[model samples]
Target: MTDTPGVSDPVAGKTTGASSAGVQSSGRTAARGMAWTALSLVVSKLLSFGSQVALGYLLAVDTYAIFALLTTAMIFVNGFQNPGVSKMLIQQHDRLDEILPDYSAFALWLGSIGLVLFLVVGIGFEMTYDVRPLFWVIALAGLSIPLKAATTVYMAVMSVNYDFRAISMAEMKRSLFYYVVLVGAAALGAAGYTMALALAAATLFHVALLKRATPGLRLSWKLTPRRFWQMTVEMRWVLLSSFLFALGMNGDYLLLGEMLSAEELGYYFFGFTLVANLTVMISMGINQALLPLFSKLKHDLAQLRRQYLRISGAVTLMISILCIGLVGIGPMLVHLVWGGKWDPAIVVVVSIAAVLPVRLTANLAGVVFESQGAWGWRLMTLIWDAGFILICAFVGATLDGFNGATIAVALQRLVSGLLTFPLAANMIGIAPRRTVGFFARCFTVYGAVVVAMLLADPWRGVSVHDSTLILRPMLETAAALAVFLAYNLAFNRELMVAMLGILRRKKTP
Candidate 1:
């Protein structure tokens, strides 16, 4: 279930006795979980990406702009609904069942609050910007909040069981369902109505699927003032951390929503959403199983440190390759997939892709720290990250407009991600220097691949709307990836071997 390609039962064999058994079980769980999650997420992302491509390609730029802005607001609102109740429950899962009823109440209340909050924000936005038809868009998106809450309780159960297969499959189905509806809606040209219908359908599916998946789990409508208050107090740090993290992540979109023209923002959003969602689809898809796995190893500091290096290192390496690969092919991808109309997003996507390796590293380490209950630690890092990005985005946007803001935000992410290492070292109980090999290996591969891409004639010109030109970049990316794979084979053999083993794993009787 963990995305770490560097560990399984064999790696866990470095330890002995009860700790060894625990690590072994976690390894096995992680291996099986990662297998299903990886395979499933590919399908899920393809489906989700298809829908998005449809939206951007078929719809007008303004239509896409309205869609992106509405989704940005909706995502921002959704973030505040849960501080980390489900995450904390995964850590202290033994008591999860007993508190399930109370947790349901808390989640429901949060969703309800978020719904009202989003509505108010929507009204304010329209009043301020005079953006039309978007208020209804906001309303439809906001209404999905409670329906999503309906799935939270059962999802917690799945997390406790390390059932990433169920979680991943559900996400795949949701994406499939959403894609079907969204693409169909885009075809009919009722952009706002299309979004509203798709959201309603996808969210309702969340409730129905999880209910069947975790049959014994049930939601409670009854709320208790005392218990809710107690839970809120206990989760205060987590709540603030969650809210800050959300604001930090979404702050750029919120800012851009105001700063850029709808068309410009739409182009930026297309690029951002592509990589941003792709990043999460790949990163968090695996992180689904990492938290509980990390929690299990929290007490085994020696094993924890080892697993942290192996897992986080491998993840960073993959991100490096992805960044390099995307940089080489980004322009052609825009042409091949979404059309020449989205050419403005090419630089946006490439710039964002360039800095994403560190972001992924921070995310993988993030679960490690969260598993250790370092809420305060996480909160501080997020504050700096959020603030840095906001300042950078504002200045860049003001000075040069859309492209400047995109690059600035990317730079901010890289800086914040790198600086979190010292704090991450303390939280993960490792020496900060231990992660040096990670940075060296990833950077080496990135440099080598980029050099290879450049040597492969990355600057070659292609005719507009000519589909044949894409093959050149695709070949260039493939060659670049070959360099990455060869570099790993030469120096990262053990990690690669372990990753292959994990991918080949199957469920045992």
Candidate 2:
């Protein structure tokens, strides 16, 4: 199964020794994993997007605002829960079965701690911020702690095992279930929709269904205290790094809510959610297989460096193309998918999209970090994350409201992306200069594409009215992609070939 694409043998694609055959059969495994993961994510996103569109149609903006706030708070609380420990376990890949029971206890305990902490935070936030009555509805969603813990365990196990097919299927099922619940609740109106979202652990339930499908793995309730302490000590640095990363990522929303109206915050919130979730989905697809693959190759400096550039370049191209397309047609998408009411969010979406290539690169940096298994390397990102939040807070307070905050976020992410190269190089034992040179080539390609987009239409009208006006965006996007693809093909030949080869393999397989 591992020797070649779709092979029946589990260790068929081994490039290493025969006894350790499965270890070396990662390329085909990665390809198959990426394909299934991509399919699952694309399907799930489409379904979720459809639900959001329906929700937009049926619910009032205020109701959506409440729902968005709940999710944001959930994201914040989840930071304390420290889901990164799961990734750490998968990456470490040593004594996992013995370690699993202990780590599971830690996850449960963390969930308990997170629940208490968040409830306090939630109550204080309401009192201090003087939030609405429905804010309590948001806090009630914390009851899903065990479900989240279970999910962390299951997802980590599957990822470590390179079972992308199982992961993808489970994800697709969860997305469908959530969408069904969402649509059913929305039909009953605002309160029902809110309840459905808060209770949207439908995915967690589906994990049971998945367990039945793959029967060997069993869930254990035994709490191993000593192991739990050991795991926690090991994961403390990971926890800090993850917390900082989350802060940098979500700090803008926190600020927007504090400084701007819920309505304005809602608009920016929607764009930020859409962009971040999409990037996460992409990252998940690649990272699911990449972490274990990178971990296995950690000692092979040459292979590690080669894979790093290939993965990073492919991700950069995908995100850059997505950004170009969205920027060109974002207003129309907002109008068509979300109705005219969300037109305010279009510019925010475009601006966020423009800077997402950097965020994607940062994800590559994360893969490198996870592979290195060195906690201190992530300390630099901790500083970066803190600095970014401070920057956002200062700029958002002093500048033009919501839009200013969004711009600040874009600038911050660009810096994060640039900072990733040296950090990634330090961990992977690559020359910092070589990594920088690779990015410089990518930057040159991206810059040329942007220049062409500007030259073709310096002041492309992005504003929308009654008309759909989809053609202008389509033309602009086509023009941008043409220039970008042609430039990569002509100038960045290796990058172009790698992407084409991945696509071709997927199509043939």
Candidate 3:
């Protein structure tokens, strides 16, 4: 109930020297954690990308579509497995080890329930859809739930210790294992079942490594009902929040599968995968590292607000650049890599790219809300997002098919960002206008880049049939990059300089 040692209550609007020192220390640790996470993500995503490319080439579109559907269902079920328990563990600054046994027990129980639920649902899905392979893949993947749940507990322990290096290493191993298994299975002509098998194997291996990495940690089946009940009470909103967020994010995949053809869903899945990869690189790479740090600073709203803005700005800049790059060259990249067979996915990718900056910003806001113990607000935001996107997506799918659904999804994201930004800002005592100004400045840069891209479109006069596909995108990308650099230099020079200075300091020490 009381503020942690060296943490000042935000309402007091004051801090001692010790609190300031504590804040600085936590900032450094968070930076280090983020660096490790970034490294892990870069390596893991590269492997994942390679696997996806291989699978894309090896499997038929309809087969890949089935895999994507089952994978999404597995992930949705996993989302319910002790949703906020890990976060609750991370938020605690004391008695963590004392609490581990009960937490572990709860996680195992939830995971068991999740596994059974997934099997029941998978069977029903098979019966209803008459897709036998779907049930098999889902059933096999369901085996990983308990392992993943156990891994989650250990990862939370590592996070509380600020030991992200171990976590990153475990992730790298998991990715490597997955990559090898996926390629081997695909090569053996397993099709969709390849992904399901790979996921289960990799998750089992990952849990083993995580257990080894976390010293003195052992899985327990002993549950303390009182402690479990207290944690459940504390985390009920967090669980709801997690479920709603997952529904908001992944519900579209389900919608597309049900409402559209398999080929259409496949195309949408490819584009969604690309966008989701970029998002994971930004959101999980940066935001997860910030969780522990924000928890440390939650009592000091001033520090938390400052850190949130600075980090959000930097993340916005990175996401904006990636989105712009995607807009300028993503279609060509798709053609070059996956061949023109995936040309249908190009529009979907571009539509999703339109809202990446806003979606990512809202994601960061969710992190802030969770860190500040504002789970109710976080849940409300997620509910609004889920409702808006599902309605828009259904309407769009009914009217104009997959492309329309893509545009509708992007619009929903923009609307959610607009609605949530001010609320998140206000929760931290930041003026809503300041939040608006921040995004306005960020989007101004984005808008300039977009206009420059339009003006720099190298294929404007060239016929698509005659133009050199590779050369056109390359030239256009170069032009867009040059314009972006010029704009930033001319207008955002100070911000650039400050970022460079921070990097310089980090390198020096």
Candidate 4:
């Protein structure tokens, strides 16, 4: 009967009936948004995986490296432009239509400046290195920033409206078009111009389609100095945070590539890609609706506290079970399927997977920060965590090479996760101990079950060559997952059911 994600009397009887109406309305909106986002995510992930496979098949390894390098460069280019600021549109308390024009103007100026800066850095790299074709890739691919900037406001508008159906379909279609173009180019012969053109084409296409999605919305050339300055102040922290986030995301590749041999780095990438992609599919997909939902309840502290606990607790429970499942099942499947080609990375993969409960739990805290417009607080978490990750990578690589560095990456996430707990608690005015204790209990229950099953792993003796090697691990994984689910149902049933109910298909009148 509760509208919020209640766990053990969330502000028990403190909420008025008027506040409860907002909860019920938000729950419904979140449910619909989540459903579309999930659909889009599944299709997009499949397209992404397929495109990579297709590209790898069509292009030679070295040929594709150029494409990959350019892609990385483009991400940095976008990051430097403080792309995260555009998302501030979703958190604005003002009327969106009133502000959209000014915001769009701000985006134009930001994007133009960004494109110029990207050109400067990129051209410098190419000139200094005397790398052929690099300059064109840099110039052409950089156009997407300006193009994307033009549409960022509209995108934010849709997100605030929770019209995820529009956003989701646009993403899937945009990705599909991009891959199709990229793959076609690879088939002809991989070229930098091809990558840049494909990238630009996709951005323009999405912009055009999104315009159709919001027929009344259009870009305007209107900006006030006060509004512009205010916008800058709002985004200053998040801009730096975005850059640091990009650094943390790609730091492993950059650092490991330099320290380790090509083959060794390849193994590390293999492990990371597997883990990161799974994280994106599960955590990011589910949490996409949080910002808009949180923004709606930002004024309602009692409801925010309850919903935050509900979502964070649910995420913790799910991630704990998933992390253990991946560890339990990964080795057996890798050995049997790839015939141990990736055996060297089993430890690297397992080490990263081991910390998922915390890493994922920490991500939920971000929604609270952004929704409350605590951009500086969000930036602090990123600065400490992202900086620590790179520092740990260096020390870890020096101490233990690839394995050491990856494990260090896991360690940095745990530290960050711990840091996030207090920040989110303080910002939302919830008890830190209560939030921390809830997360801890989730991990403990699932952790004990998974550990017990690992200890009792009966089919440990099965040979990798035997097909039956997977059966026991699979069963044990299933048993642990069942226990985790059952534990939630027994003790945390209301929160679990609330999440399920939100995600359930509601009958329309």
Candidate 5:
């Protein structure tokens, strides 16, 4: 049997026998870390969704939009402070204990700087735009920056040490705090409640937990100018790549906010958040499991490729099916679940769902590059964004004014999927044509399933008021999905086995 990525290669084959040992050890460690992160993510997403649901019911969509804008602006400003040094520390080969303190100090100083920046920017934006309430949100949300920076380092330590239990507990605490606070504060209404809950969860709670978690954690300004310079130099490229990727991923919301009204943006944002959450769950789960192990098994490219496809294909398949089903029944489900007020979101919901597989694929590509220490590929994210713009423009020209924009957003994902071919090829060292073909196959499968569902619909005779009208779409969609999965598994037996293995392991001890 051949060695697998994150399973059989380490030290680039220089110390073959010993490297195998490290790979074995690291795999277990990374798996443990992933387990904890998964737990936290699950809990956090659940609580967050529930909180949002309650808030939405109580608050108007406009208030939600305000909350969204504040959160987005805060994220944009704080982006400058986080430069990925935490990953550098975690991924390095040695001396984590020594490395941890430097990172801690750097985080503190960066947080301080970030806090000041937030204040200045918050005041300026709020005053100029008459968004004074945002000033308070920014001021309060500012605390998450340093706390995030610090928690980031602490999480890095956990990953490096493979102590996922601690990491999971910390996240669980954070999520629980957010839900409890949000629920309690919702009594007062939306804006204040959201702000208060965010502060408690992200800022104060994080800091307290981080401090308790790291008994000896300390920060100092003792680092030499030379070291700081080196850190900056190394981090700049990674930061650039990360920023581009984040911008590309997030820019659509900004665009929507500018091009459309608040109500439209609100619908788009909610749908986008829902789909993005699903993508995050799958992509992050695999990545968190794979990256640390990849550090140990860097040489086993073949194994890496196999494992990559196995995990990625499974995720892609699941997301694809869920997305297609949503497109068919999403509007109905949204109406049924959220009530009449959220009816506007149904159109955008299906539109956003259409691009989920593409988004997930691109996210996976980023994870691959991140694991390989390939910062250059980050530029591809911008290229993908360019495609988003192009497709958005195309859809706008073809469809009804605002509806066109929303549809264009989904079309952008398809364009992004096509655009990422070369990037994926470069990252994986596969032929560009072949790599494109692989993704094309995925798209074809998903599209075929969707097409079949549409074909089966009895459009000629179907009545809107008939109970069977609603059930018909669901039934046809389910059948199409069954066919899609059967075909997918038949063509990719290894992938199916791997997915089965993953599921079995989850069920096992």
Candidate 6:
């Protein structure tokens, strides 16, 4: 090798060639995985949106509120119980096959604990609040915890292997099954109980599919104590962050349910869901991919920093445009879609839509923090944000009812973003001044668009009840997007170039 294994050595050349081929193959696999995942998220969101539309029309406001409340409670419980063990399994660089049994066992134990906690809470709610219907619905839905836990274990295994195609197929199947049951139940005139029952059925079906897809993943209750403790230690902050974040997001719904009538809660929930869906879609599509991508580059700070800033900036620009456009046309779309029944939600949508970009930025930053294993900082940020939202929501609801609550929610998002952006930027090696300047420019552009829309009065003649309800909103949204695109091309050409570069990289290998 002294003289033969140099640059011109045939064996060395073959080795280099094979190494290059391996890198190319890996890149292709990653690209395909991301594509499948993105497609899955889009399809799942569309299906869920369609279901919401159908349910919005089919169910009474109070019924929808009850369903929303139950689901919100379920989310809160799940968040509270998340130990992040599954996430640890995904992020850990070990042989997953060796740990599968232990992970399964831990998940099963956790599920049992969650089930007991839910039952106790249900009883307490029945006793304290005396909301019999809500208590029963939550109690029945709580039965799905074990099924969900099992599904999570299987999903973690799949995710670690980058088998996103399997995950996507499973998700699509679950969504389809759930919607079928939901619509059928609604057609049969079932109320909140329908949601509870559908959740149980869908989860059971999902677990069955997971078992079939992932053979030999038998649920175990034999967790190794040492491994369990290690996971707990690793995931302690993640669990706290999850719980606090969940409380921040869902605590308002619980408060509103307690203070307001079901119908009023329904109106707020509808508006919140509509506006929040856009944020969720963006987060799911982008943030979900960021963790794995960032993980791969964790050793390269410069590359990570460049990617973080570019992606975050691009996300901000895109979301700002969407939010500004929605500010112009959201109310009209709501009117056209749900008519007079949901007209009360218009103000809520407008207020909440204004906060989407801020909230999304903070959310995306959390993904970056997680990828870098910056758990303590993430926890602190989440705690601060959650506390702010909780206090603001309580005060706002107390002061001015639902609309005030919506405003408070928006203000909370704004404060959270302002406070967290510097911290996130610092962790990612991005300068605070740069982050602030970027957001300022985005805000200025968004503000200009809003002012222009107000001056134009695009929705003055549109009527929710009229057949031509979609025309004005469509025209206005299209015009707003066109103008925003032109503005970006002129002033933010660098952002566009960076975005294109990102796309090219994704396609290159």
Each model's TM-score, in the order given? 0.91, 0.87, 0.90, 0.84, 0.83, 0.85
Question: Of models 2 and 5, which has the larger TM-score?
Answer: 2
Instruction: Residues 362-429, candidate 1: write the lDDT tens digits.
Output: 67767777888887778888788778878988998999999889889888877866778646765655
Across residues 204-300, which tens digit of lDDT does each residue of candidate 5 receive? 6876786787777664556676776776676777656645655565555545555566666667667665666666555545555666666544456
Per-residue C-alpha lDDT of model 3 across residues 157-193, encoded as one tens digit per residue: 8888888789889888888998999999989998879
Candidate 3: clashing pairs of residues: none
TM-score of 3: 0.90
Report the number of clashing residue pairs per model: 2, 5, 0, 0, 2, 0
- Residue 32, candidate 2: Cα error in Å is 2.4
Report the CA-based lDDT of candidate 4 relative to the real structure: 0.68
TM-score of 5: 0.83
User: Lowest-scoring 10 consecutive residues by lDDT in candidate 1?
Assistant: 1-10
Give lDDT tens digits, candidate 2, residues 60-101.
655545655565566556645555757767876776887677
Q: Please report the TM-score between candidate 2 and the true structure.
A: 0.87
Off by over 4 Å in 3: 1-23, 130-132, 224-234, 451-469, 489-509
lDDT of each: 0.72, 0.67, 0.74, 0.68, 0.62, 0.69
Best by TM-score: 1
- The positional error of residue 452 in candidate 3, measured at the CA in angstroms, is 4.9
The order by descending lDDT is 3, 1, 6, 4, 2, 5
Candidate 2 Cα misplacement greater than 4 A, ranges: 1-24, 79-82, 191-199, 224-227, 451-470, 500-509
lDDT of 5: 0.62
Report the C-alpha lDDT of model 6 over 318-397, residue by residue, as the tens digit: 66776777778776766667766787887777777777777777877787777778888988998787778778878888
Better of 2 and 5 by lDDT: 2
